[model samples]
Structures are given as C-alpha cells and as structure tokens.
Target: MTDTALSLNTIQVGANARVGDYLALLKPRVMSLVVFTGFAGLFVAPGTLHPLLAAVAVLCIAIGAGAAGAINMWYDRDIDAIMERTRRRPIPSGLIEPAEALAFGVTLSLFYVMLMGLAVNWTAAGLLALANGFYVFVYTIWLKRRTPQNIVIGGAAGAFPPMIGWAAVSGTVELESIALFLIIFMWTPPHFWALALYRAGDYAAAGVPMLPVVAGPEVTRRQIVFYSAILAPLAMTPVVLGFAGWLYAVIAGLLGLAFIALAVQVWRETGERAARRLFGFSILYLFVLFSALIAEQALAPRFAGLPGTGLGLWG
Candidate 1:
C-alpha cells in the first residue's frame, strides 16, 4: 500500500467544501457527453414516450454517470495526488474528504437508480445502477491499479449509457443497442490509449498501471491502431442492423476511415503531438457518430418510403 493509502484517515481535508467542489466531484464535463449519448439512444429507439418521461430518463442516466465519477474520484484520491493531471482534483486537492465524496456518490447513485425505475423502466434503472457499481468495484477498486488492460475492461461502464437509454424506450435490450455498446467499447481503448501515450509521465508518477506505464509506448501505439481498425468497420453495423440508414452509413464510413487514418498516424509517429490530436479527434468522432444517428432517424424516413432508396431498413 502507498503512504497516502496507509494514512488516509490522517489526511487533513479542506474545511470548506464549496459548491464548485461538489460539482467537480461529478466530472461535469464528461457528464455532458454521457447526457448527449444517452439522450440520442433513447430518442432513436423505436418507441413512443411522453417527452417529459423521456427527459426524466436522460436525467437519471446523467446523474448516475456523475455519481460514478464522484466515487471514482474518491477511491483514486491516493494516486490522484501523485499525478499532475489529477493532482488538483477535489479529493486529491483536499477540497473534499474521501468519506464525504463517497457518501455523496452513494446517495446520488441510489436516488438516481430509484428515480429511473419509477419514472421509466426497471431495466433501464438496473442498467444505470449496474454501470455505477461496475465502475467503482470492477474498474476503480480492481483493474485500475492492477492491470494495464484496465480501460479495456472498465470501458464497459461508460458504454452502458446508450444501452440503458435504449432500454428506457424499448423496455428491453436488443441487438441494435448492443451494437451501440460495442461501438463505444471498442472506441475506448484507442481514445484512452491516445491520451495515455501523451500522459505517460503522469501515469508513471502516479503508479497507475495505464498501458503506457506498463507496456512500452510502441506496444501501446500498435494497440491503438489495432482497436481503431476494428472500430472503423464496426461503426457501420447499426445501418445493417436496421436501426440506422444510409445517411448514417455514409457519415460513419467517412468518420470511421478518418479515425483509422489518425490511428495510423499515431502508430507511425514517435511523439505526443499525433497522440494528442487523436485524443481530441476521438471525442469529435464519437459525438459526430451519435449525432449522425439523430440526423438519420429524423431524415431517413423521408427517403425510405420511396422504393430502392436503400436507406431505412425497417421502412
């Protein structure tokens, strides 16, 4: 165990934990992406829902994701204090005590799960709750410190939102929702590895077993390209599965190819710049992919009714 871990109870916490500190625990910036993806999944699922109810479901997912983030910050405070990238986080910076952050996270997590079950469907709520538990126990407590493959397995927590959103409408999961889950699951390694490549020093200093810290940079770069190759082709599955249309296919194709190209650049290069660009582009790539789904769901209906358009499979 580390010194911080050994002396956790002895650490002095900041006296005044402000509103901003509480919000910081939630990792609000990442929460925005979760909200958008969750909403898109619910919106595009083939079912009718009252707009108010749909809003509630999205809110539950956002809160659940944020709650998970808070717990992650709480548990990882020991290492966070060592990493430059995370040293200033709420718990690590001493702005919030670990006990308080853990309690806050647990409270919000239970409330969000209950609200989702009451307002939407139990399946969605179950998925929401499961995401948080899995993130904290499987990812944070176990894999994060133990293995280089932490993000690969832990990424499942982040991928669950879209599926939970799909369940909010359909009340059950389907092959289509699984496809969305896989898209994000595969995207995570390359996306996270890109950042890890550039932030190797942080991981090394923090004693976190991120790929770049455990595996050589060359291996990490290769893995990024390897995952990107799989993600590119897999991104088109929604079209084939009947949930998306040609517009989505076209957009996914372009973006997928561009993603592969960026991955290749990262693989060939020996510096942080390419890795940094891939990290930034990965965020845009995922956002555009989901947005394309929204666009196709809205516009694909117009062309589907016309025969031979080859747009919407269900239409």
Candidate 2:
C-alpha cells in the first residue's frame, strides 16, 4: 500500500511538471470580476432561473474567462517578461511553458462552451465562447502589440460577462442587457488608464503601447478625467432610465462624485503617488457602485409598493 501511494504521488508530481503550471496562467483575480458581473446580470434580469442552472451558467462563464486569461498569458509571454507588472506571470516566469498554457486554455474553452450549451441554453453558451475567443484571438493576438487603442477595443471582452449573464436568464439580448454592457464598457477605460498612468514605465519597458506610455502621463491624466466625466452621467443613467432604485441612485451619485474627484486629483497632481491613489480609488468606486446595485435589488422586495421606494427614478 505504501509503495502504491508513493508511485501515485510520483506520477502526480511529474504531471505537475507538465500541466499544473498552466493552471496558474489563468488570471484568477480578473476571472472573479467576470463571475461577479455575470452573476449581477443574472440576478437583475427580470426573470426566474433555476438555482442549479444559474450556478452552472456562472460556473461556465468563470471557466471560460479563466481560459481566456490563460491564453492571454500564453500569447503575451514575450512582452510580459519585460513588464514589471507581468514579469512573474506563469509563462514569463518559467513556471509554465507557453504551449502548455495555450493547450490548457483551448481545452478549457471548448469544455466550458460545450458544457454551457448542454447545461444552459446554446445562445448564452455561444456568447460565452465567443467572448473567450475574442479576448484571445482579437485582443491578445491582434490588438495588444499592434495598437495603443488596445485597451479601448479590448474592453469589450471584459464587458461581456453581464451580457452573458443576461442571456443566460433571458436566453436573448435586449436593450437592458446592452445598457449593462455599455456601463461596464465605458467604466473600463478610466479604470485601466489610471493604472496605466502610474505604470507607464512598465508598459514602456514591455513594448505594450499603452496610452500612457505613448501619449505621456499628463495626456493620460486628462484622458482619465475626460472618461470619468463621461462615466459619471452614464452611471446615473440607470436611475434616470427607471432601472434602479433611489438607493442605487444615491449610491451611484455619491460614488460618481468621489470617482470624479479622484480623477480630478489625478489630473492635477504630477506625481506617481497620485496616480496610484486614483488607481486604488477607481477600484473602490467600481466595487461600491456595483454593490449599490446589488443592495438596492436585495431591498426591493421589502420596499415594494412603498411610495418613496420607487421614487425619483430607477425604482
């Protein structure tokens, strides 16, 4: 029995050398946001979903997102090795070989799409698979190295989770889903550019042509503020459009103010520290903003039919 156990352990360790590292290639932090936004889309859509099916749909979305991340790491290994931000990623760090990461991503992508089709509806599953493919083939392969607008265009990949979630619930797309998609799509540029402003040197080192690296920090700061200005109104649109409650409206308004204030500070301050501060605050802004939506939704049942509950828009 001991000998057999030792043999099995040996096999596992050897297999790790071949395949384990590739799993680390997936950017799990990014995947978490994808899953969260997808769930939010599912929850907010005006429909019922069997809990089991909802769980399966979210799971498949997560796996598909991770697959895209793995493929991204595989493809970006060259520049990743030079970028301080990505130098330690699996493929660049020598923990995983690029081919292994590619294979892992491809396998998981196929599996998730097929399983989603079987477990959920084909439309939702197909969209999920398409998002993965777009992230890998379009963003990573075509856009990243070639263009400064990489993030602007590639942001669509990240924005799809909510759409995917909406599709999972409705089995179709609609204006509401498109609204959710637009909100995130607009939100992404300012959020990422803040990071890019502070990390311009890293991007320059990596040859990644991020806006900040190419356009200069001051230009990036102005762009960040500009985008934040655009996003501020868009954030409140749900309220105006009668899609959210006052609770969400108030939260969105307050967070939007804070977000704009941070961007203003970033625009004025000429230091990396300020950029870092704005970057951190941008993340909090997004989390709190989304959380407001979830919270209002949760409280809606209790507040239903109350006069002020639906008052002043988005109720």
Candidate 3:
C-alpha cells in the first residue's frame, strides 16, 4: 500500500477508537442505575409531569450522571491506570485524552443542567447540578484519595437522583424524597466496601484510601455488616413514611435481610468469594428494592382495592 493511503487508514482507525472510548468515559453501567433510580423518583412522586417533560427530566439525570462519570474518569486517570479494574478505561488505556475527556464532561454537565432548568423545574435542575458537582468535586477530587470514609460521604452524590426525580414532578423536595435519598446513601458503604474488601490490593497499589486498604479486611468486613444493618431498615423508610405500600415493605424487607445475610457471611468467611458475593448481591438488593417501589406505585391505580395497593399503610 502507498504510504499516504496507509496513513489515512491509520487515522480512520484512531478516529473510530475515540468514538467508543468517549462513551466508555461516561461509565454506562453506573449511569443505568442513576437512570433507573431517577425514573423511580419521578414515577412515585405525588404529582404528574407531562410524559414528554418527564422524559426530558430523566434524560437530563442520565446525562448529568454520565457527565460526572466522564469527569471522574478524567480526574482519576492516574489511579485508574494503576488499579487493575480500571486500567483498561478510556483515558488509562490511551484511547482518549484527559483534556478531551474533561472538556466533554464539562460540556455535558453544563448542557444537561441548563436543559433541566429550562425543560423541568429549577428545583430538579439545582439538585442535578448539585449531584454533578458533588460527584466531581467532593467525591472524585477531595475524598477519593484522602480518606477511608470516601464512599461514605461520596455516596451522597449517587443518592441525589431520587430527590431530583421527585423535585421534577413535585417542584419541591419532600420528606418522601429524602427517604429515597437515605436508602441509597446508607446502601452505598456496604456495597462499595464489599468490592473494596476483595480489591484491597488494587486500592493500596493505587494509593486510594478505600476502607479495606486502610483498615484490615476484618475491620472492613465488620463495617460492611454495620452499614448493612442500617441499610436494611433504611430501605423500608418509604413504607414507614406512607409513600410505599406493603408490597414494597415486604420485598424490601426480604432484600434487606438477604443483604444483611451476605454482609454477615462476608464478615465470617475468610475468602474473597464471600466479599464478591456480597458485592454482587448488594447491587441486586438495591435494584430489587427500588423496583419494588416502582411496581407498587405503578400498580396502585389498577389494584386500588387490593390489600397493600393504593392506600399504602396510612391511606
């Protein structure tokens, strides 16, 4: 092949690589949970938003989450390169430039927050902006490398979605929305510590002060049980608050128990597998708990007469 033609082909391949790499910077797996929880908040809120506007609200949340993830990848590229789990990420893998990722993240963050303010209520937009800022500044920059309590406080960023979702419809933050926020906030420590327990070596190598890396695995395991114990009851806050019904109560109770069971096993077992299991189950537990709330809310109109349907405990 001619040298010019070969050069052109190489350029094309590089361009193609960037396309996918940019998306990877957004951390789509994490974005999915943000979207689901945000939607759940919107779905269960007391008032109604136009379907089109509702879509916009959810889209804004998703984009805001993605924007934060991109910025996180940009900021953490150094430690990400060192950590085994994140070594192949876009910036660390050299598929994308840090400057480009930062620009992309900042652009999306501004765009989504503005779009939310214009399309939805400013309350929701403000919360979205707060979430993005907290994730980028508080969690990624300040906390991640500084303290073992990183995820404990940083988890607040992830917890904002439901509150934002509620504000989208209600035009104000409510006690029920705060209950949703607390669920994820409390769940985050146990969920992340489980992974940290198993990946303590990677955290230490990266100089990230994850719980297990700073304290021993035994301490991490104990902390996990402690957080899980709190989370089990926190998950039921919706039912107690009268926003969710017995359906949600029962499912959340079961899931919370299972979550505690897994945490206990992580504490007792001397194997990484136990930690891994807790990590995996923690994801399922949150997903199912939120899913139960969505289901109960969605079915409430149709099953109004049924037990544990429309009225909730107080209604």
Candidate 4:
C-alpha cells in the first residue's frame, strides 16, 4: 500500500492558514442539508416554537453534523489519501493535522449537544449527539471497513436530522417524524450506491469494501434499482399519512418515478460513463425530491383546520 502519510506531506507548510480551510473541514455542504431538512421537519410539526429557540436548535444540529464530518475525515484520512476523489481534503492533504481535526470535532460535538439541551430540549440534543456518535463510532470506525452494508445501516445518522427537527418543535417524537425520517433513510442507499458505482476504482484502491467494489458493478446496480423501487413510494407516504396534501403527493410521485427510471438505466449501464451520469442525476433527484416536499408543504394552500394553514410555515 502507498504510504498514507505521504499524502499529508504534499501540503505546503502552514497551508490551512486561511479561515476557509477550517470551515471547509466542517463540511458546510453536508451540514446545510442537515439544517434545512431539520428545519422543514420542524415546520411540518403541529405546534409553534419560539423562533429564536428553533433557530438555535437548527444551528446545533448543523454544528453537530459538521463536527461529525470532521471526525469522520480524521478517521478516514488513510483511505481518503488513497482515493482520487478525496486526496485533497484538508486532513488527507496535510493542511490540517488529524489530531487537530479530532479535537475540533469532539469539542464542537460536546458544545452543540450541551447547548442544545440547555436551550431547547433534551430529546433534540440527545438525537444530535447520538447522530455524531453513530457516524463516528458506528459508521466510520466499525462498519465502514468491515461490510458493504455499512452505508445502508449507518445511513441512520443522516436520517436523524428530520427527527431532531420534529423533536425540537414538538418536544417529542411521533408518527409524522418517523415518516420524515423514512424519506431520507430510504433515499440514502440509491444515492450513495450510485456514487459508489462510478467511484468503485477509487474505493477498491483504498481497500474499502464499497458495495460496487465487493459485490461487483452488476450486483451494485441491481441493488440500486431495488432500493429505488422501495424509495419511490416511501417518499410519498407523508401525503398518504395526511401530513401532506395532494400537491406533495403529485410532485413526490413524479420525482420518485423519475428517480426509479434513472436507477433502472443505471442498472443497464456497463461502464464509467454511464455510472457518472447516474451519479450526477442521483444528486439532482434528491434535491428535487426534497425541494418538492418543502414547496408543497410551505407554499400550497391548505384545507380547513388542517395543519397546512398559512399561519405556520409548513401549511
């Protein structure tokens, strides 16, 4: 194996000098999705919140997510150094010491969870902390290197945001929160497996057993289609369960079908070019799917006495 530490040696001395590298270490893109989806869940919940407290809750979730990402980067530094797609990350590229990343992540994790508990409620804060721990201890350290099913099970970390949001608003969990959780949970596999299909070489070189690497491209492709088939209807369950209305149903149905079709095409693909297309489209599919949910919940008119009234954000 190539010397993993050598990748860090390539960084210019004091390379993470700017404020931006530290911010980049926090993985803002991933945090943004966490924060937004959590907020949407809060909005959809059947209650009012102190706006400032709700803001603090979302902020805590975002920081906690970033902290987890930082720690994940620290632990995965070796594999990251080997992967072409991740060779330039701050830790792998030596812009930030792995120890520094670890300390930063731990500190933020403690701070966010504690502050959230004190400022909001214990339930939301607990979920945030649990997600951080699960991502690091369960996904990064254990399952990732051991099994191809890692992402499937470990995806619970990513799906926790909506549950956290719902808890923040309601100070409890409920059926609708589970629905929101299921939406993201089901969406995770196909989305990630699509990327794995395209990036199988990088994963294989790193000695990581991604689905596409361990099972081969054909098996991964079939699994993606199977997961997409399951995901399509689950994405629309919120509407069926009465948390959302017809608008959401229509939009989610259409997007879910499109997602399945794309996965089917990907199943038939034989090489990198096709995998790349599927990978790119999967990101778009997720964004569109979530955006449709937000739009239908926030903008569409509501029926009488239903939670979709204009008084709250989700109506």
lDDT of 1 at 69: 95
State in Å the error of residue 252, model 1: 0.4
TM-score of 3: 0.92
TM-score-based ranking? 3, 1, 4, 2
Against the unseen true structure, what C-alpha lDDT does each candidate score? 0.88, 0.80, 0.88, 0.82
Name the candidate, 3 or 4, with the larger lDDT value.
3
Clashing pairs in 1: none
Tens digits of lDDT, candidate 3, 156-262: 99999989998998899989899999999999999899998888999999999998888889998999999999998988778777787788888988998888899
Compute the lDDT of residue 271 as modeled in candidate 2: 82
Off by over 4 Å in 1: 1-14, 302-315
Q: Clash pairs of candidate 3?
A: none
Off by over 4 Å in 2: 1-20, 301-315
86: Cα error in model 2, Å:
1.3
- The lDDT, on a scale of 0 to 1, for candidate 3 is 0.88
Q: 1-315, model 2: which lDDT tens digit per residue? A: 699898988665225354545556667778778888888777776666777888999999998999989888888889889988888787777766578778888899999999989988898898998899889888899998888888888988998998898788778987767877887888888888888887888888888888988888888888889988888888876666555778887888888888889889999999878778877887777677777766676677345222222112232
Model 1 C-alpha lDDT per residue in residues 138-174, reported as the tens digit of each score: 9999999999999999999999988998898889988
